[model samples]
Target: MSDPHIISAAVQEQRAAIVSQRDFENLYKQYAPFLLRVCQALCHDENLAADMMQEVFCSIWDRRTTISVKGSWENYLYRCAKYQYYNHQRSLSRFRTVQDSVFAASDESDDSTQEHIEYRELTHNVNQLVEQLPDQCRKVYQMSRGEGLNTAEISKELSLSEKTVKNHLTKALGFLRRNIEALFAFIFLIS
Candidate 1:
């Protein structure tokens, strides 16, 4: 069996090295997969879980100078991941609440009737512009804006590279901006 003193010395050396980028990279390489699994189990969405895992690592790296892991590093990392997941959930909940309130207020406003009509017209025109986009660009723009999918998710669903998806979205936006300058200018004046 290995000597307990030797094992203790190795752990002490590792703990002392945690402030260095190389040590942090080693820690990330060793623990990122396990942390991602934990995040996936908690968040229940692959994209959100990946984001949470990244956030956990970012927090760890930011706090490296002051972090004090008393016991198992695995436990400490898991706790950080859990906290990040909870924070993400809370932020999403708050955003939804604010969105709901805004919609509710808008619905209750009779003065907004004309504004709503104008908004719908603008939306129809925008849809027409989107439909006029090249086939691949139209598909990417629709999936991103109408379906609310992120670039990575859109890339996976459509079997395209993420960079390609981004390029398509950029092209679509540029097309819209050029075609809808008048409508956007009106919007800019109002809001």
Candidate 2:
């Protein structure tokens, strides 16, 4: 009584509607190698391509509930592969940036250690010269240079006249210059 073509068509529609678990499994198995090949062609790296293929399949599985396969399944899988490839490329770029920063910081630390050693040596030599100054002159010099005080502030703190403070700083500078010149001359002679 019923047309066979119509009945067959109805059964086919029912089968599409159900979308059996076995069909999805077979789809994954069939397309996996193809997807991996597509990924490899895009990335040119086997391990990265494999990772992208897995990510693409995981994304598809997550959205499988609402999937309406309009065109060939091959086209859809290829599009997914393309997106995954781009995403992986972006991840690679970010990883490179992090690696570069880590290397740059290590290099900076090496340079900083050299600079710190030079600074310590210079400060130690200056401290030794400062220690050789007269007691009151040394205190005034420390307040002016170490504590960053002006002559007026140093005079107020030490209960000395501003003229006296100025004289102390001038004497301290003359002492440091003479000491540094003599030390450099001695080093040159030794060398």
lDDT of 1 by residue, 1-191 (tens): 99999998887666753688988888888998999899899888876676667667767788888776766878887898889878667755655665575467568886677767867997899988888999999999999999999999999999999978976876677567556765554544554
In candidate 2, list every pair of residues with a backbone clash.
none
**Candidate No. with top lDDT:** 1
Tell me the RMSD of model 2 versus the true structure.
Answer: 29.4
Sequence-dependent TM-score of model 2: 0.46
lDDT, model 2: 0.75
Q: Give candidate 1's whole-model lDDT.
A: 0.78
Give candidate 2's error at residue 163 in angstroms: 90
Q: Worst 10-residue stretch by lDDT in candidate 2?
A: 11-20
Model 2 C-alpha lDDT per residue in residues 1-191, reported as the tens digit of each score? 99999987776554343145776678888998999899899989886676667667656666666565545668878998998777656645655665566467567677777667756876898899999999999999999999999999999999999978876886686568557656544544553
RMSD of every candidate to native, in Å, equals: 10.0, 29.4
| Clash count per candidate | 0, 0
> In candidate 2, which residue ranges exceed 4 Å CA deviation?
1-20, 111-191
Which residue window of length 10 is worst by lDDT in model 1? 182-191
TM-score (all chains, Cα) for each model: 0.54, 0.46
